[model samples]
Target: MTSPYAQQGFRVGFDWGPAGAAAVPGSIVAVVDVLSFTTAVTVAVDLGIDVYPYRWRDETAVAYAEQLDAVLAVGRSQEGITLSPASIRQAQGVRRLVLPSPNGSTISQQLSDSGSTVLAVSLRNTSAAADWVAARLTADPSLTVVAIAAGERWTDGSLRPAVEDLWGAGAFVAGLADRGVGPLSPEARAAAAAYREVAGELPEVLHECAGGRELAAYGFAGDVVVAAEVDISGLVPVLQGSRLSESSKPSRFCPVT
Candidate 1:
């Protein structure tokens, strides 16, 4: 029997974190973490860098980066090329980077073994990611897609359901709907509706949201601005094996209006 939690009847689904990802398995899975992870990925991919998602920023991450000949991103306060999108944007001479996060990156690494074609989605690249998924769906009628919002963790180490990720996932969901790729699950529809409600005021809302405010307090306000540049990116970062690189498929979809 198909698990009801899998949202089996829908062509598109939405859920939160690693558990949600496990519940709603799809041929294509998009992991969204708007405050940082996915946003940083978009920026890095935009600069022609390959991003390898890691679960922790410890010595293990250093060894993994060495194994792949990549630079390991440090904490925001510690040095060069942190997880902040602005840091990735300003970085140069980096062909590959290992970025670790407890939320998005961890979930991404967990899903790497699920046999799903994983894509990194953020406000900056929703259109491109959606278009890529939609094109694949058109080619394969059996294909299903799931958008996972990698919400932050609470102090006690529980999901905090970050609003920024909701919007980011919703933006990708809405993009798929706009491209006529629907029959969406209720969770997916709700996310799309939420995105539509705040489409016009994304920058302001992101700046004011808890995650955004926290980053701003840490002096990373510019990262929030970069993350809020909805539809500005044309590159789709697709996971191949353990690293995410630009999709080789040529995009034929219309730009977001």
Candidate 2:
């Protein structure tokens, strides 16, 4: 019997964080963390850099980077490459980067062993990512795609649903729906509706959302601007093994709904 919590009998699904990702295992999971993590990955992959998502920025992450011969992204306040999409965009000479974040990256790493084909999705690449997933669904109609919004953590380490991530995941969901890719689960439909409601004012909405305001307060408002570049990217960063690289072919432009 299918678990009631799992959005079974649906081609597309939407959920939040690691627990949400685990609920719908073996689906094609798109991890959406638009504020920075996945957005940074999109920018890095667009620049031809391979991204390894690590769960935390610690000694373990440092060792993991060394094992992969990749540079580890530092905290925003620290020097060197950070989670800011702008930082990754301006970075020089680094080909492989281990990006660690509490929300997106942690959920991604948690899903690494769950048999889901993971794609790093953000506002910048939602259309392309949705197109890629749609093509795969065409090839295998049995496949399920779940968009997981990697929300932020509260001061006590609980989930804090971030609207920016909702918009990012919703954008992907909306694109899939536009491509005739559903039978969307109600959660997915809600996400799509959220995106459509704010589609016309995305830039302003993102800039003023809780996540955006937090980043702006930290002087990383430019990163929010980059993340708000909706559908501007054609690169789809698909995870293979532990690293995320561009899909085999460049994605064709597909206008989002």
Candidate 3:
């Protein structure tokens, strides 16, 4: 019980738009913009959320909070977004609170600031990334791992808004933490397997997306596809405030290769 088993660590799920899904203090924060920011952050947000297709993100925290139907308290920045008492009603359905993010900026930013160890995840590196995080728990047991999907836009479980980053991220979570791999819940296991089943070229899938296409116009087409793979980075970038930098990198809890 002195190890990961004894710790108060818990697993939770949420959608990461610009305002990333929030993590508990001192938890591990994983960000996946299988479509954009994972690529966009790697490249740079200076491109302004797509120069042409131009992303849509709110200006401030107060305005974003007002958009929700319930008293859903949202936290965000240009980096990522997070929600409290994780629930789907806040995500979709009639009068759904539109997630304010160009890609996963706000959420990305939160993961950076939350003091939680952060890893950029996707369908590409599901095994490797989660292994990287789980190994860390042996030493730091108070792990609060939050898988914030670079979610897609859905209406009545069909279509409305569009994006693919969430798909890739979801698959990674399922592959690594769910399905009995890492003490995950059955619900999480089901979700993970679902994503893994369709896991493929994440970036290409989202290339035609609003933000992805916009990025292409801004001369960042290749970046999207590149960020889709796992273990591609020699450095698993960390989020600090609104910036993705190598300085916050975790101390090799698992092999990057």
Candidate 4:
């Protein structure tokens, strides 16, 4: 019995939230959190810092950082650098950064043991990420890819499908299709359409989305800009164990066997 997902040529898929992520059957998972988490990771990795993804800002995170001898990042209001990409871009003397976030980090941690090749992505490296994933799929045609948008949490703790993340994921979906990697599922197709709809107005669209507006109101609008910059980096952050580090080689797929 062939699965409908594969029947639809869904070697690629896109959906939002942890629940949506859990439903993804792809062997390669890319988590997108444009508002911050993954965005900060992109910046930090570009600066040659390794990022440890933790699900929360609790004692475990502090202990984890201590064990790794890395600095634990705080919230935006704290003294040191937080999840804000702008702050991370300006930070110095940090070899490794332990970043905790409710969405991206949680997804990263949850998928760590799922045996899938997990990848971290944001708009900052959307095109590069697409290329990286394409290489993997090219090497192993049996593997599928899923781009999961780690949407924000609403006031009632429900998942809010963020437009920025949708755009980010869509960009990857579109880029993959452009590269002729393989056929895309309806879900992936819709994300690509959504991305094409707003590709020309990314910065302004980021400024206007609900998540973007919230960050702007909190005086972190520049972070949104950082997230809106597409293809500014060629680095791809890959998850090995529980940490995200720069891909040793971005042009080829290094499968975990």
Listed per candidate, the RMSD to the true structure in angstroms reads: 5.2, 5.1, 12.9, 3.6
lDDT of 2 by residue, 1-257 (tens): 88888988899999998889888754699999998899999999999888888888889888888877789999999888999898887899998898999889888878877788999999999999989999999899889999999999999998999999999999999999999998999999999999999999979999989989999998999999999898899999987777888988343322111
Per-candidate TM-scores read 0.95, 0.95, 0.52, 0.93
- Cα lDDT over the full model 3: 0.45
Question: Which digits, one per residue and each the tens of the lDDT, describe model 4 over residues 1-257?
Answer: 55453423568888777787777667888899998988999999999888888888999888888887888999899878899999998888997788999999989988888888888888889889989889888998898999999999888999988888889999888999998876787888899999999999878988998898999899999998898888898999998766788888332222221
Pairing residues by index, what is the TM-score of model 3?
A: 0.52
lDDT of 3 by residue, 1-257 (tens): 23332223345343444333532232666766665445433332112111111134335434433432212223421122222112211233222122334445445545554566655554445565666665665556555466666554453533223345556556656655643335553434555665665556544565665756765685655544555555443344454433344433433222111
Candidate 2 ranges beyond 4 A from true positions: 249-257
How badly does each model clash, as a count of residue pairs? 0, 0, 27, 0
Global CA lDDT of candidate 1, please?
Answer: 0.92
Give the runs in model 3 whose Cα sits over 4 Å from its true position: 1-26, 43-101, 111-115, 122-128, 152-163, 178-181, 200-224, 227-230, 247-257
- Highest TM-score, which number? 1
In angstroms, how far off is 163's CA in candidate 3? 5.5
| Cα misplacement distance, residue 247 of candidate 2 (Å) | 1.3
Q: Which sequence of candidate numbers ranks them by TM-score, best first? A: 1, 2, 4, 3
Error of 3 at 175 (Å): 4.4
Give me the displacement of residue 89 in model 3, in angstroms.
Answer: 39
